[model samples]
Target chain A: MEFILENILNLIGFIVGLTIGILSYIGFKNTGSPTLFRLGIAFLSISVGFFVVWAGYMAEDFVLQKGHIEKWVQTLGIGIQTIGYFFIAFSHSIKSFFPKSRYLRSVGMLPLFLVSAVHIEHILRSVSFILLAYGAIETILSYFEGKKKGTIFVALGLSFLAFGEFLGWYSFVFPESILYYVSISIKIAGLISLFIPISKIPLTKIKFDSEF
Target chain B: MSKINAEARMVTTYRPHMKIIGDILSTTRDDLHSDGGASVTYLIRKANVSHTRISKILSNLVSQGLLEQVNSEGTFRYKISSNGREFLVAYQTFSRFAENFGLVI
Candidate 1:
């Protein structure tokens, strides 16, 4: 248990990946969304996450490469993480952007485009995390507001996303911090949040008064 | 004492249920859902929704007497009236769907 908890990020990523698969099934079976875009996004995010884990967790910290090259690689890796998070959030909630999800086409790409010189060490990293978190929360809220709201599924997916980010980001910085394991704990919270709500939502059709 | 209705089936020369209605009152629906009621300030937050759309929902319900302004002050909150409640009961389709979903209505 201790060993598994310590590597919770990896575990949660695995679990979340599984949850997305299940959600896609349910969406198809129950809601009739018609395609597997949601599942594709979930799997893709998990892959990106695992890729980061490999680069950070398995790669030799001190390589034979030169200083300039190492910094370039590190920055490149962070860039990949940013792209991954953007799409994960996108896949989680397509409803919010309906009739103009086209706007999202540039949402993820723009921040990278306007990477101005006024920069700090991890400024992009920080800003990206904040936006991703905000986006995830927005998606969850939108799901809740839907007529056939499914708070549980959305919450579960968000848990994985938020924790995946926390773990991956924390590991990016700490690579050796004791708090490293907290990422998975965060992911666990996400899973439970989703699971609990899902079981009930299917039973309720958002009873609204004729007045509303 | 009063509530706005976003579901007016009739249109005032605006094609019914077009973006004219959807775009306008989507925000109203959001505000009402979040706060459990809506006001002018909430209407302002629904900046995307046209004043025309909000008027449609509110006025339709008012004409039906489902909503009425409760206060002399302009800062009145909209709420469901007794007629509205009766309408809501019918709208729920609870008796029909409840049986299908296996619930005791």
Candidate 2:
């Protein structure tokens, strides 16, 4: 049951990410905008990351028949997803990853020091969380500045992803619980929210006025 | 009074590079009444850009095959090429997409 649910969630994520990536790539090809190019790469990386984990699960079930996925496979998928998150955050041109407040900055670094011997998977997860959180904050700031309805959706989507990543990290601490499934579901919801604004693009409504 | 002031402020604000290109192409394609094409002066006025900037942009566009320079009579004029029309369509589409993301392209 767990494997089935996991596969379904990852498959949804993969499909959504792939669609967004293709749209961004098309936008990039049409306009030659560097932002669209970066966004294209970001979504593609995220889609591939989801595919990697789903493939790993399938391989374990069929080829290995191990009844459990390899730790390395999960780690590799998370690492790739982290790269995607980094690009998303980078696209926002975040001046600093850490919070401006000194107290918040200290709290942020506390996680790194708390781990006695940090595993690669843990480090990658932590980095992914930070990047998503930072990207969410930036998107929210943009919303406040621009007050665009579309930006609000983007901000909400990023926030959901960040919260999902935070919960995912907690899932590792309590592996026996249902947090892992919840996190995956939340991330999928975030992807859907992101799709809403993208689907609403008024392509036909755009007019080139001469008064400019 | 305030609405008029806001409109005035909007007019003075600089247009984005892509917007200027779109304006130039639009003026050449739609605003021109004749097959003789748009003169540099006419384009400069319609695009609201300086002579030097429009010259550079026109040169770039012609080189990219987006615009065709025609020597109608004694003066050179520009006509939007088929490529330019395709580019303009794509630009219009992507502009809406980018606007949704609060990005200018």
Candidate 3:
């Protein structure tokens, strides 16, 4: 029962992230907004990350009796998701920050490769939470600066995502607790809130029509 | 080098022509919604494009049913059609989405 619930929740996150990613990509194509492209990459990375973790668990439980590969897979997923969130947090500055040394950007993944030790999982989770928190704060600050409609929902969504990560980190420290389910639910709600504003974007209907 | 890049970026900020058309159409819609209609000169000023570009954009928008052409006192003006208004609404929604991510559209 627990396994089923976990897979189902991850599946939901994957679908939501995929949908938002595609929509933002379309927006990027239409508007040529660099930020939209970063947003697309962020959501798609998260979607892939969730899928990797889910698939890893399934493979470990069903096929590979390997003792600890599942944890490594989860770590890798978190690492990919962190990269996505970092791009989102620094959408505007990233281009200028690494104008000359493009390869240096891959250095961010160093922590993931080194995080195989059991105790290091908690540290990785904390780092992921911090990245998410930074992104949320940036969104909230943008909202305050613009005061645009629907931005509040975006800010709210990022807050919930950060909060959910915090809870997940706490649950990891004290296993077999209610925080696990609560964190999953909060993260799901965050994805939904982030989706609320973009749900009405007219991707298919944006093309110009023939006149009367 | 940075200065040159910044100058180039400023020039190409609204590039590839399509986005400029959308911006002008949407701006024209805003003018129509608030002031009932707008002239080519008004669109040029509001859309921050050159006279030739705004003229071309207005013609394209009219052909696409996004704007209705109006002629008064031998001068051509334009009003937002229903479709144009809908486009503006959708564009606003898209802009808001992008803005939430700190992207200026």
Tens digits of per-residue lDDT for model 2, B1-105: 999988997888757788899999989888988888999999998899999999999999999999999998999999999889878887877766655455556
Q: Output the number of the lDDT-best candidate.
A: 2
Candidate 2, residue B49: how far the Cα is off, in Å: 3.7
TM-score of chain B of 1: 0.44
Deviation of model 3 at A115, angstroms = 9.7
Pick out the ten consecutive residues of candidate 1 chain B with the lowest summed lDDT: B96-105
Across A1-212, the per-residue lDDT of candidate 2 in tens digits comes to: 78987798678778877987887787777767787888888889988988999999999998999889988998898888888888888887766665799899899788788873868788887788888888878877766756778877877887888888899888889997889888878887887787788887755543333331
Q: Give a tens-digit lDDT track for model 1, residues A1-212.
A: 43346235445554555554454444333322323344435444554544454344334334542322244444554565455555555544435643466677668557555665534325445554654575556655544444333443554456465655566566756765655456556655654554443344333443332333
Which pairs clash inside model 1? A156-A194, A159-A190, A210-B88, B2-B79, B24-B49
DockQ of 1: 0.03
User: CA lDDT of each candidate?
Assistant: 0.46, 0.82, 0.73
Candidate 1, superposed: residue stretches over 4 Å from native: A1-6, A22-35, A51-84, A91-128, A143-153, A156-179, A191-212, B1-3, B8-105
User: In model 2, which regions exceed 4 Å deviation?
Assistant: A96-116, A141-148, A200-212, B1-16, B33-35, B45-48
Compute DockQ for each candidate against the true complex: 0.03, 0.29, 0.26
- In candidate 3, list every pair of residues with a backbone clash: none
